[model samples]
Target: LQEYGLVSYHSLNLLKTQALALGLPPADLRSIKARYSFAWNDQGIKYLGITLPGKFEDIVSTNHKKVFAETKSLLLRWRLVRLSWLGRAAAVKMTILPKLLYVFRMLPVPVPKPLLNVVHRDISSYIWNGKRPRIPFKVLSAPLEDEGLKFPQILAYHKAAAIASLSESLLIHQPLWTYIQSIALPGHSFPGLLFTPSKSRPPLPTALQITRWSQNVMTNTYSPGPMPHNTVGGS
Candidate 1:
């Protein structure tokens, strides 16, 4: 059976030689489009719907644009049908938010404040059908038992996904991605870094982003106080 996979290597000549040794056809090797840090014209490759190796901010921005465009197009089509406000809210929850939520879970990066503001505004406009809103967004986002529509809160969802990703990394059997990220975090353990001051933490973006997110989760969920710590052994 013939199987194909992406090959990443530091040298094209070495890669070609290895591929030839593995019985891969020379023609297939020649046809492969290679991307690397130095490729001026090559954007990152897309895998599982994400464009990799690009600036995190740029990737999040691109995702937001695509999601926004798709959402607007969907809302435009839905406008042709006579849906009530509750129906429209349900559509937004069912259709629109899921798209962004997928991106949120996949990327697990902080969405820029301006982009978030734009998303909230666009969702508001789409849900209200360009009319003045009769209900406040906060009330709309509350549960139905609280006399609300149970609208999805985009920012809150994003934060939850990021915090979940961070928690996953802390598991005793760390994931491959967590192990890879630890290389960037040299000398400091993940738990140790959690207790470290913001200025003292390593300069890894994902670590810092997740730390801030975890802090935000704690701040919102509890009263402010110095976090208690236990030292097991003397250093």
Candidate 2:
């Protein structure tokens, strides 16, 4: 169990180390892709077509605005009916529906192994079968960390598309979109939010010091003590 505790929790420790190295209030560059168009020739990137206006704000301004507006109106009506009971909570939570939609738009979908393999084979065939020389390994190896071995743009598009497609797919499988309601929405209570700079211990839990002393004490106490004082003074 102790060994399991160390290795099993390596990632947790790694994340802490990374967070500490990053210093306090970790630096994150909120991608501006959603609200603003990149200088790159977006039209030239044919693969990115499926996800144009890709910035977080661009979706709300263009794609999700209609859904948000309609839902806001409907929620407003619902609030009017029960304002005395749930107005404030509804206003705080429901008002962020559009933002929630934008964030959900970023979730990566879980692609099954067989289907993803097929897609990889398809992409490889499409690239390698062309009459021209194949794209160099440098291009193909751009996203080594990601499974698809696609360029960043393609990776982002696939991730976003996976989220979009899966959300729709779940509805297709279940119909009624009822299951979507259970999906977690971002909140202060999320585990990611509770995270602080790695070097600092969180104040909420009582101060529990993790130290070598405990391990030393455990090892010494559990070990056989001085061979039980040698009954006959010999083996």
Candidate 3:
């Protein structure tokens, strides 16, 4: 109450409405306070300083834009002075990759392919002194011993990151998976969802995108004995 100097009248009204939506009476002090929250702006609302959005996919896409912007800034630094081919490769692998890894590890949502291409362009321009790449990207991205530089294809990292999220609960089979199962997946099991092929409509963008990516990672990495742990359905 305003008399107690705890909260403003406007905050109290917002809390009251939110509490009512949860089927709690506004008069209940516990419910009122618990429902209390503040928005940073009209476009964003932060709870405890965390910006959770209406759609799950927005979180990933928004963060990726930020990563891209920061990477772009870094890339501009080298626009005037191009690094050696080896030096540029190292920067891409080391400096740029980690910026991506931070968000990729945190959220496994689909990243737009074009955004990755933008990063690739920056790296390529820096490497060749603003000239186009002479070698095919596939050849240039090969391992060091294969008479080519070892540049990590960002998409592969995206797929692996997505696979890591889907395989998280499957690998452990923890109680937390109960929450995942409850989320709009009705009759589908996560194992069948990932391992079993389906033509049915995808449940969520995260689910669909991650499944497609997992398939790609599995197909690309399939070999004798190397896939001992990740194998499913004998393939």
Strongest candidate by lDDT: 1
Please tell me which predicted candidate would have the highest TM-score against the true structure: 1
Model 3, residue 115: C-alpha shift (Å): 2.4
Mind sharing the TM-score for model 1?
A: 0.67
TM-score leaderboard ranking: 1, 3, 2
Backbone clash total for model 2 is 4
lDDT of 2 by residue, 111-185 (tens): 334543433333333334323535553554566575434332323343444334333433435544323322332
The digit string of per-residue lDDT tens for model 1 on 90-203 reads 888888888888888887766676777777877787678889898999899889899976788877887777667767766888777777666766776765654455545556
C-alpha RMSD of each candidate structure in angstroms: 8.4, 27.8, 7.8
Model 3's alpha-carbon lDDT is 0.62
Worst 10 residues of 2 by lDDT: 15-24
Q: Candidate 1 regions off by >4 Å?
A: 1-41, 53-57, 195-235
TM-score of each: 0.67, 0.21, 0.63
Clashing pairs in 1: none
Candidate 3, run of 10 with poorest lDDT: 15-24
